[model samples]
Target: MKEKVLILNIGRCAWGRCIFCGYSRENYPEPNLLRMKVDLDRKLVGFEGDTLKIFGSGSFLDDKQFPREFRRYLVEKCKKKGIKHLTIESRPEFITEDTLLDFDGIDLTVAIGLEVADNDILKKLGKGMTVEDYTRAADIIHSKGFKVRTYLLVNPPFVDDIKESLDRSVSFALQHSDSIVLINLLPHANAPLFDLWVEGKWKPLTREKFFEITRPYANNPKIELDVETFRFVPRFPPEKRANLEGVSSEILNHPHFRVWQEYLCDWYEKPKDKTIALFLPCSAKKPYSKSKTHTLIYKTIKTLPIFKNIHRLVISTPGVVPFEFNDFYPFNAYEWDERLETPEIKKEYIKVTKKRIFDYLKHHKYDHYFCFFKYSAESYIALQEACNELGVSCTNCLSRETYEALKEEKGNPLFKEEALKELREVLSKVKQKGT
Candidate 1:
């Protein structure tokens, strides 16, 4: 398999003042500041990948002054290399009928980061274009016979109703484009919005909260929803933190932590013989962008013969492939939260899962539905409820027994000694408090 090559440019953001935007700082280095075209060409020459993706900072269309020579160079070089797919990004305002014509015969995919479809939210985020602009841009791109992709940013700032905003965005994308990318916002120090956090004016969403918010988009079928995140907290050693800052300790201890713990626990759990139906709710977090969890799932699935009998059904936005599982059914949800932790986030998580289960049962009934992660608990509960409604049996692998079994399997003598030390410290604290 040829490795994928990505030519990224963080564009000089046109809407540099959106309240929730952390990548909109005025002094951030522009693509024009670097030897962009030369670097891209150099990278392309050595890359042996089947796909050459020209992407990164600022919109491809934002650099209106980029020499036509550079564009021509990219096309001719890609054609010569026999690159299978060429991709680029642009803002809605930068796309027009004439702009589409410029690419002519180059085999490529053009994507625009529209973020949201609501005009009010667009203005709130300082997105320069409206829904109509995006629609028109999609029409123009499609008319040129190029694949059109739209990027939707769920749970943007100033948007009180997260679900409504996501529904509207997904609806718009489904109606307009061939594919949609759903990205959850992460606050970074470089964005204009970071100061809001520094000034205690804003609070970033936890991973759990973000998953709950993006659940709806994850389920959509009409368009693909690709989950990308800026947050990178390592689940294990040898995984260094990405350029993003550390997440809160509270988020670290959140209930969903058990989900990952349970996943690690799966190694010890005796593989059940029942027909397992894997239900993945839409998540704002993309495994490709963040953790090894996706890879772990793929590996686990391969090792367990149970997966052969498993029916995987994912409900999410259209665009990115959800998983390597054989059976997938996608659906759209009302909202996506980009934050990771909170009670409200948990509530929404439960609600979306319930909706998915209801939809699944109504169409196709299953023997038993097993959720791999805690994020899918809502779906699990819904399945339980559906079972109750129809008197069927449903169970999860991440029960208390599974956790206990996992602890026994991870029998590192050092780990046991550390636990004993921690226990002594805790008892000492209790004795001191009583005294």
Candidate 2:
């Protein structure tokens, strides 16, 4: 049966600081709610559809954004229109118990922003809510027997590794929501993310990378994923798109692309016999090896050659990426946390850091594990907790002088200045070598 859908514009978003959203593009031109009663009644006079998608340009349930009478009228109009079901655009916070009751008779499918599962990305995007918050909202939604529909943000900012970011996004959404909606971020003149884009900080994922990430989920016996997810929001139209052809196949098979297992490898070429390990926090620098903090750490470590086994690995959110392989693929070209301070995000940092740290220790026996991170504990708090849990003690080796010197020479090394420069450069080189 063909599903007839009705999209009704109900005002500007009440909470509209989402970094990717454009004020004029996503929400605006306040509709005269004075005529809302007569207008909606006329619009739905003889309307017949399976679904009624209401857009307030904001949260449909937020009374401040959409008046209570308008919301109640929506349900009344849908019922009068003979609509069997209704779907509405709302942020996570608006999906409350009382909100659900407002549309009790209709089969309600609440579309909430499960934007991205990673809290770090959420922080960068100005998405106020946390993953824990989303989980609670999702549970509340499901517990009430209301259908759950999630809107996932594609090509969200703060990561140079676009492909990895997409894969993580899809995987997270599939496990959480019933129907997955991939909303591709289209940058506009006044978009919050545009400022970051021009500064060479935030880059949208290309069409080529998007296809690569979607390929694996094609035949999965899970929930249906939607491409036309941005019904009310702006999309990356054809003319504005990057060329989506000729991505390297070797990249598809590379270990870096397969992050889950690549991160869990039991053995590498690094000498493990009585080795001295330098555990460092992630940097804003593209490759941690090139970062001033890392450079200083190397200089300090090299002074003592007698400490033979010098193994360096970065403590990053994408698991433990080896220091030597830092310049390879994603690690070399990607970006991560700049000033992460949320306690909510901190809990997540500990979970991933614990797994990668333990995996590193389990495979190799280091004579001494020296954590030289002089940054805030938020950066390496996971590593500390992980080491303690594993009955392993990591020494804090870097002195205050080294820490101060590292900060003095820091710069925005990861910023690419143009869209997809690092991704294209890395891909072109890798493709030429036939890897």
Candidate 3:
């Protein structure tokens, strides 16, 4: 049987934050009953397939996207038009019995984006829903006498073991889904996974890998392989992220910035030693080592006896970056100044930074945590909040009194004598713990 897919617009997704979603770049018109009906008529003019798969920019069951009246209208229209099977996509959260009602005469299957099985990996992709969420939704759909189609993403980003993740995801999907659609994760310039791919942290799955991973499901009638997606997985280097002319506030507000922040903290493996972690603010200069302020801070930090075991990290615009990754693509590529950002962007920065810092500290244990930044900096606020939540003390190199004293200074506050004095005093108190 021939299959026809219709890509419709539904204004925006309820959760449009998936790192691998290319639809984030799309701007859809607000869903109106009359307008959507007209658009659907135009798209259905030449429909000839026995199976019709309707894909909206987001969930088809979302009332904001498809009103109840329009939804009933569409189902009746499809039945009238002699369409035998209808497939529609929706996020698991929207798969309630009320939403799935009124389509008794038609054969309907609700497709859900159940990308992965592991909750940790799902969080890294910013999927916004967990495996359990998908399971619950799937059970509801099945109980309502409707079929569930699971969209499985192969070789998603931030996964250390590709085969294991895919294997787990496929196994989990099989148990919960009546049908499985295998999609090779495609790279989009506007998506977060693209940055990870560009930075060499992730790569596209090879044809060999795809075949090997999907071998067990080859004979299953329910598994539908999406061969076309693999064709669009760009293998060439992405030119958009590099060689940009100058730093602008727009770059910091982009979606990739948030993804970069989440992945940076998620992927980092802390050092084995129970060493002191010294968090410093990023500089406009690339690699941070090239910045004059960072150079002076490094010089001063080296003088401390505990410095021998201290691990230096930058609380950068892209979130935390270890000193060793200073030369990495995003770490070295972008420049940011909190002053240039709008109030909204700055507030988001603080929220994202705080969560990331908390998550990083939660996983990566350190004997001691200390931070040296301008007392009034955004990173300082986030670090303080994160440390407080963890019940761990993070010594601030620049004391509040010193920040008050130097806030109005002509030069950078970091270089002032009082700030350095505070740094020395704080370091002196943190005795070097045995490695």
Candidate 4:
């Protein structure tokens, strides 16, 4: 990206868990901030950007997470680099005058998570701070000649409907902050929302519903809603996350897929040929084709040309997505936590998934239905059970016919071993670099 953005993840977020965020557990973990600084120093060898963003999980002002000496060094480093705008993610409580004073000359901006103005939602998300506290912090930052950016969630837990919450979140944010970032929920781990999902309390917001709710604020320039969050996944394993501040050309240049625009409604184009239906769960990476899970599945079924032109759909939080739409905005751009895979949660997902899958099946006529997905396909199991209840047949990898047909005529017998070899090689390279 010409913008020269430096997205850094220092360590775990200081305030512990935010019910909605998995940054602490998913990204950096309880990392040695000192070692993180050293690694960052190594990666910044050729950073020639004028704009700087210090976005590790913790509050930049938190002395414990980011030592005073290290913070001072970063400030001096940015100053020496001639940085124009400097921004960091922190809590409203940490927006002290003393901290703002550190960015006296640089264009400073403090981004905070004021998920919504509603007191109930704040309490539910475990945001110990309140909306009033955020406003005061924003005012303090503004007084210091700096900017304040606020983040709000789209579909939070306990909200029966997403439109009401989106409107409420946008209305309050537009009035109190310089910019607003609308974050869509990517529930996983023991995320409070995901907990609700397990009990059939909360449903993933459809793209149409999400856009319809946020349409009133669409024209507002200060409001920035990056649609990629719908399918955003945080894959930071060494080989996936490079030395480029965890940034890459594909990541930087990935298209911003919008689900809902007041002016455009034709986001999903249907497949005319209903040949054979094949469903799979989304992987932790974008472009599902590149994911190891998908690689294995494809290799297992490639010999059967008869399944070609099958209607391939990836069942995700956004609902059923055709393979043609896999690379689009919400297809693979989501970041869900890994801890949310309990047996209880799968039951809830299956119950809801069956409804969407049935709705999809009504329009498309397929000679046969098949599924081949990893454990990620919790909903697929539900789909099978749902079909059974309705006395409809859905073939899966475990099915006798499907298993018999799994061996591809030209497939490599040692594909799994080869894949593991590549994995070890990458791990060794990372280990050597750390030394």
Per-residue lDDT tens digits for candidate 2, residues 1-435, read 224454545466777778777652554446566677777777665555567666555677777767777778778877876777777777778878877778778888877786777888788788888988887777877878887777876677776666677678777776667776766665553565755543556544444455555666667655444433342212223333232111132222233323322323422445544365667676767677778766655554454434345667777655666676676545555444435335655665566567667776766666667665544554467777778878887865544444455455554322212212322232222221112
Candidate 2: Cα lDDT at 403: 47
Question: Over the full model, what C-alpha lDDT does candidate 1 score relative to the true structure?
Answer: 0.52
Would you give me the overall lDDT of model 4?
0.61
Better of 2 and 4 by lDDT: 4
Query: Which candidate order results from sorting by lDDT in descending order?
Result: 3, 4, 2, 1
All candidates: TM-score: 0.50, 0.49, 0.54, 0.59
Candidate 3 Cα deviation (angstroms), residue 319: 31
Q: What is the C-alpha RMSD of each candidate to the true structure, in Å?
A: 15.7, 19.5, 16.9, 14.4
> What are the lDDT figures for the candidates, one per model?
0.52, 0.60, 0.77, 0.61
Clashing pairs in 4: 10-56, 189-340, 231-332, 231-333, 231-334, 232-333, 232-334, 232-335, 233-334
TM-score-based ranking: 4, 3, 1, 2
Per-residue lDDT tens digits for candidate 3, residues 1-435, read: 778788886778988999988685567778788988887788888777677889877898888878888888888878877887889999989888888887776788999998888899889889999988999999988888889999988778877787788788888898988899987776775677777765668866545567777777778998987744623523223455544323354464444455454444444355665388989988878878989877888777788777777888788666777787677666687767555677777787788778778877876788888888876788899888989999999887787777877988799889877787777778777876542
* Candidate 1: tens digits of C-alpha lDDT, residues 1-435: 474646454446664565555444534444452476677666766677667666555566554434455666667777777776777877767777666656766766788878888888788667777888888888878888888888887656767777787887787687777778777665554454544433444445544566687776666664564434544221221121122212333332332232222222221121233234555444444432132433444444544434555555443322112244212111121123435446664555445445434544554444555444332344445546655776555544344444344456654221233333432232222221112
Runs with alpha carbons beyond 4 Å of true place in candidate 3: 46-49, 230-240, 244-435
Clashing residue pairs in candidate 3, if any? none
Clashes in each model (backbone N, CA, C under 3 Å)?
Answer: 44, 1, 0, 9
Q: Candidate 3: TM-score?
A: 0.54
